[model samples]
Target: MIDLMGYADRVWTGQEDLRPYFSGALREDGLLPVADGVWMWAATGNVYVFRTAGGLLLFDTGDRHTSRALHTAVRAVTQDPLHIAVFSHGHVDHVLGMDPFDQEAAERGLPRPEVIAHRHVPRRFERYVLTAGYNSAVNGRQFRAPGLKWPTVYRQPDTLYDQQLDLREADTQVLLRHGMGETDDATMAWLPDRRILCCGDFYAWNAPNAGNPQKVQRFVAEWSQALHWMAGLGAELLLPGHGVPIAGAERIRQTLLSSAALLDHLQQSVLELMNGGLTLDEVLHRVRVPAEMLSKPYLRPTYDEPEFIVRNLWRRYGGWYDGDPAALRPAPRAELAAEVAELAGGPQALARRALLLAKDGDLRLAGHLAEFAALAAAPGSAEHAEAHQARAQVMESLAADSPSFMAKSIYGWAASQSQAASRGEEPGKEEAGWAP
Candidate 1:
């Protein structure tokens, strides 16, 4: 138990260190011009607005807050109705602010801009309504779960492209290539004449978030292939869904190739282990990216952790259920907790050990011990109460030590829940961005 918990602690600590440094970027109003018929803006998430002879075409809309600015920026450029609005994927940051486009078009009696997305995107809309609770949990944003308020009255995509769709204007052709990266239904908008790839989230400047634990399996292979191919396109500019834009063809190609290299390393390493007939745990213990590879700015694990990437690859080649037999027909969480508690010399012993570990500067390990002991607790179990209290302290210490904002948020949230559990309180669980 001690060694198992220690490994989890190390893994999560590595997770804490994975988030890329927040370069203290200043937010700017959406506004950037490029080429004859193309423009871009970076509000919260980066959105590129292309000015075609037909009408205004928006590559991707930012989150809820940027809607007004998006409208303002577009109106400032041209009063033309938004002919087509493309969503890179079904991510919250990229999809929500599209309402303003609709409103602007309606006010002047123009036809509603056609919502263009991959086939699975409409399904995401359907599922958002049907499984609000499930969607909220997975979304992990502040607005999900308990107070989940997704976009309502979703206008299904009028134009759905299976593999690729060519959007040709007068002397301009923007190719919408379908490759699921951040989401199963991600689409990249390519401008041939402009030599600009408005590659939705497929080529995010931040650490690749393709391995979000709560989300669906990512097409790592497809994503790498897309980038490797896009790298050779000699595009002068690369517009991404999130983060700043990259200029210069050589730099752009290298950046894409480097991003692909990160995934390729992880994927290839996992494949090597799998081919060698190693168990999942054994592979996980040995899985490591070379220091040279991890040193890249783009490959940094800012948004998604590497272990999750390894685990995702395992699932891609493996099956739905993880390999453990106990997990196959597992006991209910409470029952398993109770059994583990009973076996670990009762909860009181667990609490004391956690206290020692916490004091010994092993807060991560202590937190896990406290979790098991705390969860197994019965209402009247004195052992449960003490364990939860110890758990809170350990988690608080861990939170204090966290190096990343996301890690701090996660550990702080967990500590708060632990504190609540100690007093037999229901810690008003607000679902957003929480893994467990």
Candidate 2:
């Protein structure tokens, strides 16, 4: 068995890299005891188990893919009936693993665990059902998993609270508070007696995922506020929705506050620029998280980048109008591409220039020029194939250069599409099979 606590201690002290913990590579197949009576099963999402005289309390069941495994692991540790399963949010990964638990209760003639979450969780489920197809496509593009399907059927919360709910299982006291962060329906569970905090996706080991480009709006300012709120609680043990458990009160405090500071800086900077009558583009270029903050191992932009966070802040405050009058009612992309190609001496010239720009490490400009060339050229023509090949190379370069998972996935998808176009095959036809 891997000494997860020792590993976590090494990671917290900077003696070990956080990648193993973050990727769940160090996770054992069974529940790992985190405290005297607290156990955590780390999967794609972390499932925390709290043993009490009443029963067992859980925070954020594992994802659908690991649901059965999680149940088996939890059962291996204890036969205690599940008392309450608290969903940190409505995201499928955090809430979909209750099926096996529910089955166990039925087979054993025990009462089903009461599901609890914020009031907005059901609304989030409804929205998921409404945008099932769009969610499927975007998630597929984000994770680089072709033909990924979004689950419309959700395990709704049996009990919902607006602000806070407190529960007592014998001597233990668990406080559930609603907060807006990565998702509006986020719940933070506090175990006062044990001085442990079950913070959902709010404090994932990587940078705060407040600006996932492919998802719904995230609350940046509110997210920082929630982090600050958690920091103030003086948690001795931090059990996050993902990653290994963090020990030590001061270490937990510093980690939470540092993450909070990064988000606060970005939010305030964006707000300051937005208040100054700057356009979204101008604000995006001006606002930046400090290099020192990004250097923090826990705040690295491995999943979501700071630039995307700035854009999300703008979207939250400035709405869809990016202050670009031309963008307010833009010309058809193909028409504009044709006009630009004509100015540049045809699609062939544009493609050659794009390849040249790519060679010079100007991937952003190269991508634009290559895409325009491909759009302007006649379909099935030699020029079209040349332009698409250029586009594919540029996109692949962009993917290679990106440190963020989201950016890399998107650029990779774009490259895949361009590769198909270059081969004279229909783009996105492979993806159509999974469309709702």
Q: Give me the candidate number with maximum TM-score.
A: 2
Model 1's alpha-carbon lDDT is 0.71
Q: What TM-score against the true fold does each predicted structure earn?
A: 0.85, 0.96
Highest lDDT: give the candidate number: 2
lDDT of 2 at 393: 90
Tens digits of per-residue lDDT for model 1 on 31-115? 5565565666665566777777878788877778677877887787777778888888876677776788788778888898888
Q: How high is the lDDT of residue 181 in model 2?
A: 91
The 0-to-1 C-alpha lDDT of every candidate, in the order given, reads 0.71, 0.87
